[model samples]
Target: MNRLFAATGFVPKKDIRGIILNRWGHAFVTPQPGFFFDTATRTAPRNTVMKGYGRISFGHAELEGFQHWGPAADQGRRAMTQALKNG
Candidate 1:
């Protein structure tokens, strides 16, 4: 499966893991146990990580029970920043 995707020149080789291989030979990482409900708005609430629609993955410890996209993006950004800072 990975070989096939690599040969097709679909997704970059470095990202071909821990996700489902889709029909387009692309990696499809399932949402991290979250959901979305669109209010027809383009942007989600500030500090809320929104995947799509109303799906959210909250970031702050105070809002841990909520789902949001801000938290997810913020988390990734924080990790990258920390890694760079460390190096």
Candidate 2:
């Protein structure tokens, strides 16, 4: 499932200022920690306090399924930075 989602080229884009959150993501913090705080949640939303906050992890290193500090993650961060800067 992790590989399948990663292959879809999907990156959370709802973040207004790059804030990310996960209700219950077990995939995070281990085999796929990259998505720990962005997507791939293991539970449903229960708190309303986080409402209005941006949920996108635009250029997060591991959010894209790449291992932290990996070359691919670096490239993704760079790309997201550039995109944000250009706009």
Candidate 3:
């Protein structure tokens, strides 16, 4: 799986596990917990992390409501900046 991505010049992290090997000899894996809404909901504890990361909902609405979605081609810039600063 990692080998295939590497062959195509896509370098994936090595320490990641729980990957699913498919029939096409491709590997699919979920992102690390807390990185996205779905995974974060499953992994984050109650009272520790706000529901939907304090957004009204997930997806486009949430992104727009939280100002995470930027105008035109600059989408995610604000969110990415916030993430980097917070990190």
Listing every candidate in turn, what is its Cα RMSD in Å to the true structure after a full C-alpha superposition? 14.3, 21.2, 14.3
lDDT, candidate 1, equals 0.43
- Candidate 2 per-residue lDDT, tens place, 1-87, comes to 335565676454532346567665323323333323434554322122112134322343333445455844674666566566555
Instruction: Report the Cα lDDT for candidate 2.
Output: 0.42
Highest-scoring model, lDDT:
1
Listed in order, each prediction's TM-score against the native is 0.25, 0.22, 0.21
Q: What would the TM-score be for candidate 1 when compared with the true structure?
A: 0.25
Relative to the true structure, candidate 1 has a C-alpha RMSD (angstroms) of: 14.3
Task: Score each candidate by Cα lDDT.
Answer: 0.43, 0.42, 0.39
For candidate 2, list the clashing residue pairs, or say none: 24-42, 34-62
Model 1, span 1-87: residue lDDT tens = 665776766665566567774554433234332323225554434324422223323233222333455655665565455455554
Q: Which of 1 and 3 is the better model by TM-score?
A: 1
Q: Report the number of the highest-TM-score candidate.
A: 1
Name the regions of candidate 1 deviating beyond 4 angstroms. Answer: 1-65
